[model samples]
Target chain A: MSVSVRKTYKLYVGGKFPRSESGRVFQPAGNEAVNVARGSRKDLRDAIGAARKGLATWSGSAAYLRGQILYRIAEMLASRRDGMVQELRLGGLTPAAAQKELDNAIALTIWYAGLCDKALSLLGSQNAVQGPFFNFSTIEPTGVIGVIAPDKPALVGTLALLLPLLVGGNSVVALVSSHAPFAGLALGEVLAASDVPAGAVNLLSGHRDELAKEFAKHRDIDGLLVSGPPDAELTEAAADNVKRVRFCNLSSAAWSKVERLRSLSWVEPFVETKTLWHPVAP
Target chain B: MSGSLSPTEFRVPPVDAVALEARTADLATRSIKKDAKVQGLKLAIAMMDLTTLEGMDSPGKVRQLCQKAVAPLPARTDIPSCAAVCVYPDLVKIAAQAVAGSGVRVASVATGFPSGRTDRRTKLREVELAVRAGASEIDMVIDRGAFLSGRYGAVYDEVCAVKEACGDAHLKVILETGELKTYDNVRRASRIAILGGADFIKTSTGKVSPASTRPVALLMLETVRDHYLETGKMVGVKAAGGIRSAKDALRYLVLVAETCGDAWLSPEWFRFGASSLLNDVLMQLEKQRTGRYQRGTDFSTD
Candidate 1:
């Protein structure tokens, strides 16, 4: 079966895939029509706008609905597993490891779906107090997360990491791996088709160095999930915005427990424990 | 978000060696004597590892030693409460009660005490237990093994996790300097710890023989002072282990005064973790004026 692919791969800004604000498009290796360039300040602002808009409803959404949306994305990705493998291989995954890549992708989705409920379960609390006031602690979403997905796991763990942050009701501005732009573009397609609420996930694929720096210093990006060892420049830039950075150190070959933290890294990036104190009343 | 990047904003500034020397001179001439039963002296900061107390002396004996050290200061003038009293995980409560209402804070070394080779959950648990036991400050040693092994993410994550475990208490990260030999390694460790949410970047636990040198203290303080310049957050610095005299504390204080500034010299930003050193500072003050050694009992351990 021959697939008639589109001539252009637009930038995923807000909820829809659109051409770059600069109207620029560049091609990565092995791709016909995908642009990997610098996203404009306007594109960043729009994603931030979408994130601010979506934060309430997404976080307010029931965990079941969040899990349902995530599980559905995984199912859809699984359904198109062969195409994903091809995309991964195109991005440099060996043909032998393509099946394992698909499995990892599927498992990542499910694992994150499970964690949506687990996060609240493990981190939340109801205090049995000495007073008549009702006090409880819930795992609140840290605003918009800035994600730099791993170049190696462009299809699976990267998307896996992104899904949990979104499902946890946090929006994200992702700098998809430049090396694996196709896989990121494909994942963006699946997210857009699902009920991910548009700006919840924005995929900016172009110059990895440029996008990573932008996300690092962008005040709009509340936290960062650096999917690999960020260079000193990137690390220093992220520090500029006081963006909470989660350095995801997944090697090019193996995916380990470290992968699990990438999801949490993004989710809790902007989290600050606000200890509210009130005088004990009569 | 990828693009060509500019230079980092978190670079350390040049040390004011001249200004530091001047402060040392000023400290030498100042008459720090007081009229009260317990006289307050401005000695260099001492940082204790708490775990080493096992070989030093008994708890009662240590308490007596602390009382004697503080005895020369004026009764109610508040001589900046012996920097801080550091102890093991279980002794935070005892230390807290011991130093209660005395302006002295009780710090407990947690996160596996000597080494940080544990799970996040376990590390956090150590912090939680220490905090719950009345530790006003927590000194957690970083996993140097993980850090040296190039596990930067794990190190960063663990430090943040331990910080969270501290609740309202301050967190002091100990970079066992004897282990992290080079100045560059010490600098990197200090920056990483401060960036990852440490309240203080300390040098050494004093387990090794050569603990808490001036250069290592200089390196950690330089990083902390730079962090303050960048973000405007005042992270404290503590020099621990083998700091046994007022002169030793003075040298570290001189370094802080030079490396950071006069603003950081207050007890809030400076600490000395010595068990037997406070008395020496008091003794020095007494010797400066009176030329005779007072009997140990003449100084009240009240």
Candidate 2:
């Protein structure tokens, strides 16, 4: 006779697994209700703190190396495909839907991985001016990004929202879908096992409502990328810090446009463009 | 008379590290909110020694720091000016000039700060230079090498010399307890500095790791309490380094209040030697006032 091991879903902050500081756990819908970390505002704050520290190294890496790291994430997810399928099944998805979403997530990771180095040239510009000077514009990653993943297709939605932000070199503090957070937690495990640096992508498993206000108001977070309809209260709260807020409604039709999802426009909002003017030699 | 007690005469009873840690942990749980939280936040702000000690420090940076110390957030006049603007001896004149009428004192780090490796003559001269440059407070580092080698007398004598060199200027002796290794050494060193005429006993230079932990600070506070009981003199305690948030600062205040009683709660009795802590305190104050969270970018980074 053999015994099966059960996994405890915990918050991934600074690339380390930690139970919620509040010591509260919630059960997501599954055959067996697994205990997931019910993160608090303090947990979100800690994740932001970690992301801020991780941003320095992640944003400073060469674009090519970042691309390679994203590819490694795809490789890790592919290796864990069976586990992801099982997680999706437990969350009430059909086996076919589970396998499809897992495949889409891996493909999504690879899609963004290919754009890391190309984002700059495709988005940046060299300008012609009347003055005796040279002017050029280039994109730099926003320091830290806060993400709120959607409810359905947990694996693909979270990855679709997160990969674009990460490929642009911004570290993320994401609150996974409350209904199907196990997939996000599993992805976090894959991310940890992959070469993605600790703190580069901190995953918090909790209610979006509990963590959204903090995600908006945290001074350290530079931008917020939400994968649901735009929330008025969240936007208003984020206004206090002037955080850049962008929404991605990833519908089935939207997901079909893989090229559009992997475009420079997708990565542009998560980055700031700096235009430098230098004096020309006579 | 050297005005220094013989190191052999002062006795530091063995500290129960476990009990000290437990007490600190218990005090950390006491929550202050509303009016008390606001009052504690303001007190923490006033006790800050807005410090910038870096090799790359410039006149422009010192002037900006002094401006911050004086006005803090210009729009919020309710926020009190910090206790002092701490900098290198070389920047004392500029800092003094910047906060001339603002009541923010200029404190210069002297006596081979962060490391007391230089000779006594050079260290005393450094203090004299800062005093001449209009510094009202001197933050000096003790000779950890001497203290660790059982040369307690040498360490006490050096602190006394630095105090004499300070003249009217208040002396803040940085024990650099992170380098002191053990809690017993911290206790003994605190006793020696208090006996040697340190107006204030500081925990660290903010340059070393393991700077100013809670249990170590609690032990130092106990030493201060015992010293008062023994000698009838009240010495100040400044928990410097690693104290960033208003919550952490308030915990230190709570430690002081519970350990040394309410007398040590004032800026005159307790101080925080911090550089980036001011802005965070201001942000928290703003949140309390407006019931809204703030961003770091909104505050000026001097």
Candidate 3:
């Protein structure tokens, strides 16, 4: 691959970044000629398809690999802070606030990177019962995750939620903020630049609620990470297929990486509780 | 004048053939055909039984526990919020303020709860005071002497008076079934409360001998089913006392679902009068939908 080939870095669907089938484009960076691809219904369908395929592989991936990949992504993100800061400025953040936003983004990445391994350490334990057999339980990754990024820190909050689950070996299908698609595409470009697997992160940017209902209702999507107000309708819709719902109150004054992980912890539904019982052969 | 129901006034259901025939017919029509599923499992959770939580050395700690008890339920894929939080008449204000604007209702046990020994006028006054103090619901205990001694009229009249005194506030008439002594008394008391205009009939004040039991709950739900048929009002039912877990809440939901059908599924009609139970239900729901165990202290509404 040529270094300057400009990979177009379109919506990642089915392990590939393809231009939106809609042919619709928006000026995410507000620069002429360089239009950001707007995702379409087909792209969402393809994402659901990709998530269905990657769910088994990602969930079965070793937790150590998950943690290493996550840490690597955080390191890559740290190296690209200037580029992210510039993108934030272009997306309407003030210089001072952008600096703070950049800090929060980096902090969030590092924080979640550290948590990548600890989640299993904290959630798993050995159980001692009266039965003759040794009982062990470990927290497992939920299947595919659907994320609706926060509208304000579009990239940072998205990455905050995305990294934790991804590090825990969960594939994600993200519908990013409508107003801040540039930072999302930029991050996607960065993920592509890094060695993050093609199907590991599928990022779609565009429209406030274009695919939210579908995302919530998608049968293949096991868990939903929502970083906004509790949408009762969407929540009730998720109930159609019993999707695990994790809603983050972006309006709350207090939010941190721990809160993001705790919110995203709802992904445990896809974890299969395997009980090993060996009967004595008579 | 208020001690016990006169012996002459006590009416017994037919032990003879003619009365037995009518009873059997009534049982067949009601139990087998229409309301066949009415079975009760206790669901009410009494808030702090504290007549004075302020007297405790650590009111702040108690207050924190109470707040923890009333924490917002975690999102659940199945079932719904069980019941309103029941507090003392004094703490009704705190509870109302604590859960202000929250979907959970504030219920204060009033009208001489548990004993119901206060005068009728004072009882009505207690009801009025609680409602004015911001209690969305009131759980008033019935006078067991009048109920047991077969002074049905007096028992019925007192409940009606308390319900009227409640004004717009929903009145939950606690039968103190533990003191009522038998399933028959529990059934009759439930009937009397419903006939007397109870919006919801609860099990006990959690201050009696055997607060709330499955058998008692079953009898009451049966009465509620009959009452609903006789009068189309469709009053709510609450099984208070000893309910303190998510599984407990679900059992109550199963009871309500089995007995009252899906209409009573809303928190409006069915409630678990629990203090520590809400958190468990929330944790279970969180675990069921999210797969993590969150302690009651860890999740806070305020």
Candidate 4:
């Protein structure tokens, strides 16, 4: 007789999977043995800390390296297809719905993985200025970004918003859907398997309302991305740090409209333009 | 002259390692938030020994450090100046000159600091040099080689010699507790340093791993508290090295206030030997005022 190894989904912080520091856990589907870490504000704080530090290397590294790492994440996601689909199904999706969700998530990852190195050249500009001055503008990562992923299309919604941020070298701290946290928590496992640097992608499973305010208000978070409906309170809290706040449409139908969801605009919101002026001596 | 009373004269009580750790861990859970947090953080800044002990530290760098020590938050005038700016013997003059008339003392780490591997004559000379350079505080390391080899008297005499060499400067004896190996050793070293005229008993040299851990700081604090209770002498405790966060610094404050009462909360009685800790404290203070977490980029690197 073989005994299956049950999984205790935990928070992915700074590239390591740790049980909640508070030692709290909850069942998403009420499975007897399966428990997801109920992450706290402290966990979010730790994740943000890691993301801030990770932004230096994530953004500093050559674009080619980031693309290759994202490609690795895609490969890891494909390899872990069975587990992801299982998690999606566990979150009340039909088997076919779960498979489609997993497929869309992987496709989004692969799409952004290929576009990582091209973001700068596509968005940047070299300006023709007055004599003795050569001025040029380049696109830079928006630094640490906080993601509030939607409840519906849990896996796809997360990947749709998260993958684009990484393509531009933005380190992310994501608070996944509270209703269907299983798939998102499982994605942490896939991210861990990939060569994704610690802190580059931290995934926490908890209530969106509870963490959304803290995520938006965090001064270290340079940008805030919210999926589903716009939250006025979240937007107001984000003003405390003057964060670049962007809301995304992560509906099931929107996921099918690939052109809108997979465009440069998705990546544009999380990048800042840095223009530099240098003297050209004759 | 200070070593007349041998450290061995008093049988040093062995520390309860498990209990000590449990107590520190319990004390760390104290919820110091809101107004208490802002107040505690500013107090931490005030108790800070803004240190830059790198081999590459230049005169300009020391001057800049002194500048930061004097005005931690230049935009706001509410923040108090740091307790002192801790540097090496060579840079003491620049640091002293920069912090002069600013109420920020200049402390120099001397006597083969981080490693007490030099002779008595040379060690005392380094202390003398720093004092002559206008440093009001002298941080000297204890000879672990002597202390480990059961030469307590020699170590005691060395601290006394360095203390006398300090002249008017307060002598802070660094135990380099990471090298001490055990709680019993730390307790014994604390007693020896205090008896040998240590105005302060510091934890580590920043060169060693396991520098200034909570339990170690608590043990050292306990020794100081015991000494104060018995002899009515209030020797300061500077938990140097490895104390790089505002939260950890505040816990040291909590440890002091709990073990020795509120008397040790002031900069004169307690200090934190740290460099990066200052920015973290400033960030926290800003977070308190602005109601948002802070960014390291917003603050000055020094």
Candidate-wise lDDT, in order: 0.68, 0.88, 0.66, 0.88
Q: Which docking class does model 1 fall in?
A: incorrect
The candidates, ranked best first by lDDT, are 2, 4, 1, 3
DockQ of 4: 0.80
Q: What is the number of residue pairs that collide in model 2?
A: 0
DockQ of 1: 0.00
Best by DockQ: 4
Error of 4 at A175 (Å): 1.7
| TM-score of candidate 4 against the unseen true structure | 0.92
- iRMS of each prediction in angstroms? 30.0, 2.6, 12.4, 0.7
**Which ten contiguous residues of candidate 3 chain B have the minimum total lDDT?**
B33-42
Residues B1-302, model 4: lDDT tens digits: 33466545635988999999999999999979888888899899999999999989999999999999999989989998999999999998898889889999999999988787888889989989889989999999999998998878888889888888888899999999999999999999999999889999999999899888999999999999999999999999998888878898888888988999998889989999999999999998997888777888889988
Screening candidate 3 with a backbone cut-off below 3 angstroms (N, C-alpha, C), the clashing residue pairs are B44-B239, B44-B240, B44-B273, B45-B273, B45-B274, B46-B273
**Local error of candidate 2 at A18, Å?**
2.0
The structural similarity of chain B in model 3 to the true chain B, as TM-score, is 0.74
lDDT of 2 at B186: 92
Error at B135, model 4, angstroms: 1.2
TM-score for each model: 0.44, 0.93, 0.44, 0.92
